[model samples]
Target chain A: MNIFFFHLMPYGDLDLSYTDKYDSAWVTLPNTYFDRSKGTAIYDRYIGELSLADELGFDGICVNEHHQTAYGLMPAPNLIAGALTRTTKKAKIAILGRALPLVNNPVAIAEEFAMLDQMSGGRIITGFVRGIGSEYFASGIDPTLSHARYYEAHELILRAWTEPGPFRYHGRHYSFDYVNIWPRPVQLPHPPVWIPSQGSIETIEWCAAKERKYTYLQTFSPIELAQKNFDAYRACAEKAGYKAQASQLGWAIPTYVAETDEIARRELQPHIEAFFNKFLRFPIEMRMPPGYSSIASTKMLIERKYAVRASQQTIDTLGDLGMCIYGSAKTVREKLLHHQKEMGIGNLIAMLQIATQPAEQTEKSMRLFAAEVAPYLRANASTAVAAE
Target chain B: MADNVTTETVDVRGLKLKVQQAGSGETILFLHGAGGSNWTGLLDRLATKYRVLLPEHPGFGRSQIPDWMMSVGDLALFYLDFMTASKLDNVHLAGHSLGGWLTAEIAIRNTTKLRSVSLLAPAGIAVEEAPFGDVFLWNHEQSTRAQFHDQALAEKRLTVAPDLDIALQNKSAVARLAWNPRFSNPQLPFWLHRIDKPTLLLWGREDRVIPYACHVPYKNGIAQAQMETIDLCGHAIHNEKPAEAAAVIEKFLSGVKA
Candidate 1:
């Protein structure tokens, strides 16, 4: 029942130019076209505000990674997590992920992540990602080989941490003559590997097999899709001979707390639309990159309900359907409880940056959620209700 | 065309392709980058040494976009289909960016067709700290500002001005076929290991679109890849520094029997 706040660190400019026609503006332009100097100040303010979340007794703090685009300035989310470790004492620093395979020398990853774990005193909940489509275009790595590369890289990184290295690895994808790593992790097998995905069946199967933490980062996915995915994971976990724990699966959802759902939705929609259209647009090639997913997935993306529905919907509708949760404290609680009952996901990863709405509004939403809704859930906590 | 060189329109499966064929050594198939035609200047250099065949990919210059085609995987598979139809086996394949990535994809699925593979600033592996620049969002000024180290060259390359419409048309055609999200898989990035080919990765040290350090993920994931970094280049290494890139290719090719 712990609530964690997430931010993509969106660029916001209050001034709307005379020519700035909201509806007709092509969202594909660079975010730098808008003033970005305030990002540092705003992030500092955001950090300060969310820091109070820990003081206010909220569970954990979360940060993530994206590059080049202004969607999320956290190209190195671990850096932010590292800062948070120094800033706050108790709240868990959830680096929702590092794009595991995108890193060349995973030993560095092992070293860095282990350092983060130690710095935080074992409070690091590591989320591993293959990154996303734009990453393929950005990294010069073929998307076709993403899945295998990710798995292999993850294995290498894990081994670097756990195995008394200097062991040569002759993997199909990655090979090294020497496998010795310094600064082996303090945690027995490395900090928990939290995987937040769109619930790709391959990812679900992989996570289940490894018994790692799996969270669905399908903010744009529908409730039904989330349910289906969580169900599949549970089924896979059960078939693999283990009863699934709520801590094992999570959902990264956009959330805004207000006096009422109507107020929250109305205030959040425009910024939500702007964020989605500008930063989240995916090209078809990048979306399915060759061999990143299977032919069946490619076919499903083109033919299935989820895929067709995902592609056709504009950013606004998609966000409404997939991204945020906007409501009164009671409504928020009800929805969360419902998600828990229906989907069985224990972790509730909330987007504190719910649409690049005004700073005051965002702060207000966080304060209200922390003050009102969080207590109700904590009181009714059925699972081990500590902040991850 | 040169006296010894011959260009012909050849049928490889259902694809009607214009190919430049020359030389008499090992066969090398050249795949062009986005917005490129078969007779790219880089391909011309390769044609002198090997029996090089540069086929116009469907939806590229003069090649019709096929009805059955959908994803890049389809395009990748079609290359294999093209090889089968051409009765070519054990050919060295070289591709740049999108083409290089597609080459890797095809080689991963069927390494038997390739003598070896070379990727010049190839796009596929995901790298943190450094990521490939977004080509879709770049306008002339922004693209220039974002990419090249030298501003004068950036200005020249950035100004698609007079030919903006044609450039847009070409880009749109590619988008119609390949535009997904950021040239990535939203789900996973793990297929690079599936490749069994002896791969050569060439990168530009100053590539703003995709960085030299970005080669780390590929180096980690592809067991047989040997990497080389070139200077004074961006994403388009073959275009910006062709001689160095081509020399790297030649060395990689020479190291192998092909």
Candidate 2:
């Protein structure tokens, strides 16, 4: 199975105070309060690990973009991806996105991605996003036309990447007399397109139609829902007359591995809970801003399931409920394998942010995951490993 | 922070309003932008000379969500009520972003109450040439990139806010009220001519979030307004370049006889 490790490289400050300790925790602490110096140091350390993953023989290293909020410090994952392209020889530098509509020119994306692909000799994976609803409010994009603009911008960018000569792209959101991208991508027909989704139906169906690889960024979900989403995608792929490959599905969840479940639980719980209580406290009303996505995705969590309810228990246990993994290596491996076997997930993106952890410990967790869990599974899924 | 600058809870049409009052000079009441709290850095500067009153708009900050408040105009009128109840006459109004828009709305209706109106990167003007960078779509990087000259500095200044609860709440409320037309009120330009108070149209030249071209419409529309452009600044002029922004405000305020 091809795997990638991603980190938000949160600002390293011990300031998780005004949160509900249990539910709506993620909405309280803003990402803007992260210590830049510490954030950079952590970024350098983890980015080095991402590079080491290449030496350890992982398929790819993932970095993504988020803004304002402290959940993730990466506002421009592309810049980091660009830097990684220069350092790592073997691993693919997957910029899990450049929020397309937020960008003024898709050609710049075409140019940048092509440059990275050329510089890395075809090791770039570009992910395009409509950017989630919070982003729309942060950047002030009209939510009403988000989908339209995303589709148009994506079409323009794809055309710029594929078509040989300067052509014109006249669309609703973007228009240019001549669309010429210099240094066409090293990979013919552009770098491999990876689409990251929060299980939006349109995104799933779109990826299915195009035969593109998709990752269900299992942010706040549990194994059951993750499996359901994969099932949905498989069904969508089948309906589109194509068999969905395991490589086409990627899963990411916040993970912390330690010597014992108790230790892992003790250390990781507070940080994850702090992240939740401080940053995740938003009522559903703001989170699902109108025209942000198709009404389906937002309504599912808001009016339908009562998932966005404000509560301490709900916030604290959210990660444990579905999306977070905290345990001994054996326990974590078992849980990860459960999801893999159930959903046929080939790509697993692990997040390692446990509050106030020394960089050495975080690196220790990464090293353990790399040395023990990864190699064993890579060789054969049938082999029984000690959970001891 | 002053002693009398107390947080008062007022029952405005059944909603509890959080108003931060400080200092003792002229009655200079401040209105905050979308998602802004009274404690934001900009208000700290204004609190020095004037009896600065920073009220978190309804459905924002710690203020109770008003079910009746429907639009930015509703917020403007509510603020007017707040001033009247406090007996704050000869008001020197200063606002940023949506607050600036609300200030313009208030000046048009209750011109007699305002001593002078200073708008910092106001948002009511419409420009068709170069579109404003969408403030909502920006992640921290894109947001700072759109607003600041230096990425590192902007990142440094943007201490991951302690609590985004207010931001989230404000975003939802703003989205609820303005998402239909995307915060650009089409009818607002028609009302600008009615504002007779001495208006200072302060603009940040590098403001991509609300494109600098927006100043053109205001210049053409408002008869009594004068313009001053601040260089190397963006939409959050007061927050991004406060010294320069405050300098512009001081000049504008000094020009008026309060």
Candidate 3:
């Protein structure tokens, strides 16, 4: 499958023993624990790991946005994408993505993404997200208006990129008298749009209707659940009068590789555990704010009970559940290949750099994955070929 | 008291509303807080003196929320239409928490229709010193704790499990109305002066949700307004101290001419 390296750029030095003092790693977490000097070193190391991934010939490098959270330090993924444009060559700069609802000005997104697309020489993939519910609190945006704002912003950005703007645009959530953008995108029509979701049906249907790529964020869920969601997405696309190709489907999961299974487990298990039990330890209220999700979706979520299990996940449980992949290069390769064949996912975005994982360890995992795992998968599979 | 309470569905404009009506005399409309609509003990105590009309806001309980009804102001207008359709004039108005905010909006907009306004722990005034706690961010347990001074009473009230669908529906409706500008209207202080009728502002001394400091702006802005603090009470003053809340309302309403 097409391999992409995803970086959360986490503050690896967080004292796990003291995580109990904070309600979550998100909005309410005290900033006193964050050391600026340590943060500077972490950024350089994380970005250096991404640069290594580029040198190792990964198909893409992925970054995303989160607010007021140690879960991911990228409040602005665009800036990171811009930095990647200057440092990395050939690998697509995938900002997966900018949270559309949290942003006050949609045109600024249009302008920035266009500038990045031109700077990267048409090697940019734009991903749009309705930020997680905690972001509504951090950004002071109404969670009730999230869907409306997201759709409006998406429409505004697309039109600004394609249509000759400076045209008046009026929407329920936004209104612009003079809608014009300079330095229009290098990609014709627009850069390819991808959407990542936790399998919200509304989002799946929207993505299907728009004929955009849909990436399932299998965050701490069982493989069967992801498969069911993928099936639903394919069915949704079919109902929209088009069959979804493998390239239109993607899977993002935590992955780590090493020389042997024992070594991989020994080295990565603690970091993986901390990532789930600590970094992702958000209270239910913070994760799903009032009106952030629909009644049907909320009811479905309650019935499934995935979120409860996710909160209590241990490293071993996560691995057994297939929420994460950690093993020898051979074992990791086999597992990924099985997932690709079974789920029909063409793109595999591997999150090698986890919470508290050393920079040297991340680089070693990337090199092993690139040398031992990716080459075999690339040679044997034709359907997993990159869309570009 | 239990036998006296009866429930009915009333049509307001195109929306259907579930209303609980009790006793018979001068009409008194009781608006409930953000916590879904229910028959509370205060309703029964008030029912003994005057007819208490408790209608679930358009989106709460068994009510049907029309798409156009999106804000607290829209709810105020809906209630106005309900009064007009019911052929009631110079009716007494009372509300709690979010309901209190709605009552103020109605009073400001339709000054002639109401005889007096009673706001119990109302949440429409912005106070810098004692900012309102974010109820949406709190879990059911945290919210219950913050809403009551008596933890035992809160525990007793919150023991029963909530129906998931109804809980989600109520929370969603509350978010639609009060999520932005948070719980208060920035322009509400400017318009409170328009409400010329006698107003009663009841606050809980230990209300951790909407602070007691919110009383200042309401008292200062409205003419002929009286402010009272209920000691050892919380945001749900009516629920926490039903008898006292009822007695205060009864005394206030008795002096006003309807």
Instruction: For each candidate, report its DockQ versus the true two-chain complex.
Output: 0.04, 0.06, 0.76
The best-first sequence of candidates by TM-score reads: 3, 2, 1
Q: Please list the C-alpha lDDT of all candidates, in the order they appear.
A: 0.69, 0.70, 0.85
Q: On residues B19-118, what C-alpha lDDT tens digit does candidate 2 reach at each position?
A: 8887778877787776465465555666676678888787776444465565677878888888777677899998877788788888777888888888
Better of 1 and 3 by TM-score: 3
- lDDT leader: 3
Where does the lowest 10-residue lDDT sum fall in candidate 3 chain B?
Answer: B61-70
lDDT of 3 by residue, A1-388 (tens): 5789999888677777666577688889886668777877777877888888899999999999998888888998998889899899999989998999988899999999999999999999999999998998898787878998999999999999999968999988889998899889999878988887777677778777744545544444578878887788789877887777777777888899988999999999889998988898776778888778877776776666555654566778888788899899999999988887888877788999999888778888999999998998787656553322
Report the Cα lDDT for candidate 2. 0.70
Superposed Cα deviation of residue A115, candidate 3 (Å):
1.0
Task: Please give the lDDT score at residue A149 for candidate 3.
Answer: 93
lDDT per residue for candidate 3 within B39-131, as digits (tens), equals 788888999889999988877764545667678888888888988887877788999999999999899898777888999999988799999
Give the per-residue Cα lDDT of candidate 1 at A377. Answer: 70
Q: Write the per-residue lDDT of candidate 1 for residues A24-98, one digit (tens) a residue.
A: 122334454556567678678767765766776667888887765546667788787787878888887788788
User: Evaluated against the true chain A, what TM-score does chain A of model 1 have?
Assistant: 0.87
Residue range with the least summed lDDT across 10 consecutive positions in model 3 chain A: A211-220
